[model samples]
Target: MMQLSVAIGDYDRNRPLIDGRAKIDGVDPIVMTLTPEEMFFRAMRHEAFDICELSLSSHTLRTARGDAPYIAVPAFVSRAFRHTGIIVRADSGITEPSQLKGRRVGIPEWQLTANVWIRALLQDEYGVAPQDIQWVRGGLEEAGRVEKVKLDLPDGVRIEEIGATDTLRDMLADGRIDAFMGPRAPTTFVPSNKGLRWLFADPTAEAMAYYEKTKIFPIMHVIGIRKALAEQHPWLPMAVYKAFAQSKAIALEHLSETSATKITLPFVEEQLRRAISLMGRDFWPYGVGPNRHVLEYFTASHHRQSLSARMVAIEELFHPSTLETYVI
Candidate 1:
């Protein structure tokens, strides 16, 4: 059985396939799930692993900066999901991106891919350079654990490292921080519970503009195969991609149509139904067509940032086998 590692955080939206579910039909492959942070580091380090899902902004930037080996996922998959947003307390005085100045901001993990992307958004769209804001990073720091990388502060900004989501909620409730950037549900829901509001209901324009200029989207959660492994077993990529495709279809069907069929695990029918209602239609869908905007934005923003990297060609990332099968 071929071995691959995956990273599926708490969010069910992007959870990787597991159990027999992750297996590619007609081929034997075992898949393992890693924490998001670990997956990012391992992929960058180019450690032993067949397929890995990476963060588009933080992980891909490091790869572009020559820190890791080049790994690609199909372009179609990249297009489906793109963009991250900033979350703020409801009563805070911060209204626009400019208001973020001198405020403490909560990030899920410092130096993670999302943080990197948020920084890019601030720079490209908001004109708030990374060197200008206080960044608060979060993680679990209990006994027998290493202290995570604390956020680095720029001039006139202060950063504090805190552990626990409860701390973040408390901070927001007590006005300890001005805003946070994260996945939509957590960022919006948690803050709303504490009387916080999304600072920007729509943060996709800047990202969309970036995509219009460049073809490459900063890749997040890519399932990459090492050159040697792909060479050793040429069909592995196709098999894996197809399995993910099937899983994606299943997820979408679950969202659009309802049944007593008990599709998604642990999440009961009512709960899943509620989640679908909460997310609406565009939140999750099969394939990457929806996220094309993200790549376009990344390419344009990278150009502006002086990265000088070529726009990622669609063919460079995806193989014809998976593309054709899913494209129709």
Candidate 2:
């Protein structure tokens, strides 16, 4: 059996595979549990793992430039609605997305998947074009952060930088910036801070409404295999895909054991029921066919947002071997 190094998050779905409860056929995976930031950075910059959780935006950026180091399988490991991603200063008096016009918004990276979705929704849903606001790029909690992938945005998109030591939380808390948009919320979003709130008053409701309208859950991450390894071992992508799919299935099955809450938070069963009622039994699905609408919407937004050099076809995003699966 070949040993492959893998880097991914410590989510429940991935836990089973990491703990040997699940197995990839014909291969042994040496898994490393890391934060998304560390995983994406290493994967995007160094191709540091045999398989890793890749930022969808960053992956698309590289693929468009024709230098992608990894070949992806359609196992979406991370996804979120992103309505909650837009964090505004309470004192900014920004009541709606429309009010974002002429404001300065801070972001961690232009190549962030959450920002791509947030930016697209702002323009399409509320007419808040990307060029209308001044974009400030910096770290969310520290300093000296740069875009994960280089941006070649078209004209009219004005982006600037923060001070060497400045963070998005500090700028927004003190009102230096009108709002901050990224995958993670600023630490200032607390009762004591009283400075930040999501742009949407009820982000959950807004997300559900958007889902009902567009049927998109907003994919944030994809599993990527080293391109060289994939080319050499043609069966590897599907093997990895099936292992993740099986692990996710196990996690989902665990969600329905209502005798005791499987998760730390309360209302696990209740929320699960609500999600199933709204999104069907297979709400969080994997693979190309199940998530084509989401991929199409995201690819269109990515190109329109100018994060990609060209419009990335869904067909160009995944391994051909994993594109179609045999049905038994």
Candidate 3:
């Protein structure tokens, strides 16, 4: 009976994680609700909770100069998740990356992966550097403060501290900014309500293109374990990953039943079905091998950003050396 404190997003994304089936199937569920910023804070502080699922963008915060030894999970396309995208006002004459020159772009947080990846894409593919565009950070108001995430920004980006999502929405609606960077759900909702057009969406095909070209898997989430504890209980890592994979399989089987039983907000059956289609069986594996592309990308990016001067051996990041690796 492992007392695992696995961090998950808000209620909407966490419903499936806390089901009785998980507990019965061997995951002592202790739930914590926090934004990505807060999770970054907890990881930085090296909180006692075991097994944290954090965004790759927050990996910098987690492994900051003096943090505990933790393994980041590979960035994989979860069975039903999509990459973040840039949303622009439809009629604003901003239809492509080339038009973004001199226009303002908003990011939920400066440290967010979508923001950085999109920045890299803009620079690499379209000859747009950080200096060429107005980068506005939508985050907390206290100077240099976010929930738990800290950002060390490069030059040529502007910062506009916002306290909440509504403030960001107002800003977007008022034309204070030209475009915003965020996950699909958050960015699409407000703009759609206002009939604002999505200038472009980096769909799954685009994600596959980036990977095929760069071999960089945009890490979405990583699960870390305290090094000492992991040494003491070597089996924990595989067990945890196995549990999630199994639970996901169970979730897929009872897609309709799970929705009916839980009735959790916003995660209706239709969404589950879509997620099932998106996160195909291949993306979810019983062991570490399934997310190789994600791991490779993180290793390269970490080195590229000079976040780590040395490349990480993939084996060092996973538990149970014997677990066979596979890619989807």
Best by lDDT: 2
Candidate 1 error regions (>4 Å)? 1-26, 45-48, 67-70, 75-85, 108-111, 116-132, 136-176, 184-196, 201-219, 259-293, 302-328
Off by more than 4 A, model 2: none
Report model 1's TM-score to 2 decimal places: 0.62
* RMSD list, candidates in order: 6.7, 0.9, 5.3
TM-score leaderboard ranking: 2, 3, 1
Q: How does model 3 score by TM-score?
A: 0.71
Over 205-224, each residue of candidate 2 has an lDDT whose tens digit, in order, gives 99999989988889999999
How do all models score by TM-score?
A: 0.62, 0.98, 0.71
Tell me how many clashing residue pairs each candidate has: 18, 0, 8
Per-residue error at 273 for model 1, in Å? 13
Q: How many residue pairs in model 3 have overlapping backbones?
A: 8
What residue runs in model 3 are displaced by over 4 Å at the alpha carbon? 10-17, 23-27, 33-37, 46-48, 60-69, 73-84, 124-127, 140-166, 184-188, 201-218, 256-281, 284-287, 302-313, 320-328
lDDT (C-alpha, whole model) for all candidates: 0.54, 0.90, 0.57
* Candidate 2 lowest-lDDT run of ten: 187-196
- List, residue by residue over 1-328, the lDDT tens digit for candidate 3: 6666776554323345656454323457677756655665676566645767665655544444335356644323232223346777665688777898888776666655555566666776668776777767654222343434444445455565554453455566678778777653343356437646555564567666665575454555656666676678766666665555555666555545762555546757665565456555443443446556655665565545444435665665555532464459
Query: Which has the higher lDDT value, candidate number 2 or candidate number 3?
Result: 2
What alpha-carbon RMSD in Å does predicted model 1 have with respect to the real structure?
A: 6.7
